[model samples]
Target: MSDLARPRRSVLYMPGAKARALEKARGLPADSLILDLEDAVGPTEKEAARELVVQTLKEGGFGLREVTVRVNGLDTEWGEADIRAIAAMGPDAIVVPKVNAPADLHAVERLMDDAGAPAATKIWAMMETPIGILNAREIAAATPRLACFVMGTNDLVKELGALHTEGRAEVMTSLGWCLLAARAHGLAILDGVYNAYQDEAGNRAACRLGREMGFDGKTLIHPAQLDIANAEFGPSEADVELAKRQVAAFEETRAKGEAVAVVDGKIVENLHVETAKKLIAQAEAIAKMQAG
Candidate 1:
């Protein structure tokens, strides 16, 4: 969807140590699940969580799900072992925390290769630090194996000493730059989690804003936010209908030796047609994903 490998409209973070939560995630409607071993797991429980996450990936029951493990950083006590274990038991990707530079990605790539991980083991960078956001473009262009950019807004906010407002005014500039970098290199970018799990309306508004800002999806903290995130990020019925009409009109005009067409009094050009086609394709992809 949206030229991304999958529709990440609702990416939920499931605790790596919690068996019940991981089991519950299989039934949730989220597009992807991040089996988090970094922030979610306590220091003492890291080893157990790491082992459990690997076992879950090996067991593999979450159908049509892009399962990934959010590994601890290489700087941590359990980081290297976590990466080695996860690399061996590859999921869809291995999400590393606090990736600040291209060198960081290169280091992980070397580790993954050394571990003899499968070819499909992707690398997802958590853009949380100030340096990461500053070097967003370099980090994105660092490796072909990098697949997605997950906004770690909580850490960023803490780093910047900024408040997480209802509209996310403070972090908009950083988000914009990071998004530009991701798009420049053709990688999917996901908005960070909405901390207000109890506030459904707020979460819905945030998801809408994320979609408008051109994020491929939004990371979620709870199952309750799944529906709202999916709906808000998805193409509306009206949008799909309009895209179809525009594409039809453009094709007809092209056949008549025209460079542009007018659909419903709006000028439709090649760029518009391209956008329309992507929307249509994404809608179809989402429908197929849901049906299965």
Candidate 2:
């Protein structure tokens, strides 16, 4: 699958300090996994978590799931060491936290380069600070290795001094800015995690909102939330059928030297055909990932 088309429908966060969690993650149905060495790890466990995460990556049993390591902020004591260690390991990407500007990414890129990280490993930024939201575009275009934005809504809410309402009214503007930047740069973006893990309805509702807001997927806090994220973000059977119809109808119209076709009483144009084809490709990619 193309890098852009790789399914990120359910990106679960697995605490790097927990060996059982890391082992369990290999069999989880998540489309992507963020092996977290930052917030999830207690301050006393930082070095241990980093070492454990490195060992887990070396073991490498995650089949087809995009694995990324979320390092602590560079300002923190463990951040530099985390980057130097993770960069050398070369997971799919190295996630940087609280990236306030392009300079943060550049700094991390330098550390990555100094560590001799492989070219295949990309960088994913956490858009959590107000300055980061304000400088979304520059961060998105910061480095060639930058490939994704992972929303850190919990930190963002705290940073904004705003409440986390059900509708996320407080953070919609911030989300929009990052989304625009990611799309503008052709990078994948994920929605923040839904905290109410036990509330299936609430989690589903949040996933629906994220999907409607054009998020490629959502960061999940628990394994239980994986199914809902996958279902809400991936193309449904009805959507796949519609895409197939739109593609076929557009081809037929083009054969007749026409510029438009109608599908289900809606006019389909070249732009719609293009979108339909992308949707079809995404669905196929998801299927292939699931099959593996």
Candidate 3:
């Protein structure tokens, strides 16, 4: 299956400066890893970290975890260098943080192209600033290579001068806007990381909330958060079974020249069947990743 259709239930962040952490990411169960060069790296170690990230991506110990390098923003001194360096190694995607407009994506795409980045290498834009939240739709549709939006909630909160409540009450409007934009443009949207890594209960609750918010997954700060994120976002066994039944019933109806089918005493339409097929495909993709 294509990476686009693969389940991205838990995307963990690993600091770019830590060689050991990068090496250890190979064993994590997270669906993807953002090799962070933005907030995670110190200014003094930016260049060194960039080198390490590039070397690490080329070294290739990261199993099925989709590797994406989160570069510093174009406005930063290290941003261009980070993109140019990471482009050479060609990680799955280059994540640009704090994207305020489509012009931001356009600038990054131009840099990636100039750096000889492969066509398959995608761009993951983070919707953080208030301007970014407002312009999400334009940004999502800005580039054909735009793959997903990684919400930078910490920055967002700082920008809005809003409190980080237990349920992210202040951030709901921003989240909802970005989610709508992503869905409208056929792009994947991942929820922001829960800051309280020590609070497992809080983390789990937050993950559940993100799942209920129609997020494909949640960005994680610690590997310890993976279990809850995966469980909450990945299709449950019961859900998979129901999806299987729906798909079978719909396929049978299609074979019989019918437009609809009844599954579990409920009417199933074409859209329902489509959802079922996606569920099954996602499950299969996750299974394949886990098997390896």
- lDDT digits (tens) for residues 135-176 of candidate 1: 999999999889999999999999999998987998998899
Superposition TM-score, candidate 1 onto the true structure: 0.97
Model 3: CA > 4 A from native: none
Cα RMSDs of all predictions? 1.4, 0.8, 1.2
Using alpha carbons, what is the TM-score of model 3?
0.97
Q: Residue 40 of candidate 2: its Cα lDDT?
A: 97
Candidate 3 lowest-lDDT run of ten: 1-10
RMSD of 2: 0.8
- Count clashes in each candidate, considering only residues at least 3 apart in sequence or on different chains: 0, 0, 0
Q: What does the lDDT read for residue 231 in candidate 2?
A: 94
For model 3, residues 120-184, the per-residue Cα lDDT tens digits are 89999998899999998888889999989989999999999999999789999999999999999
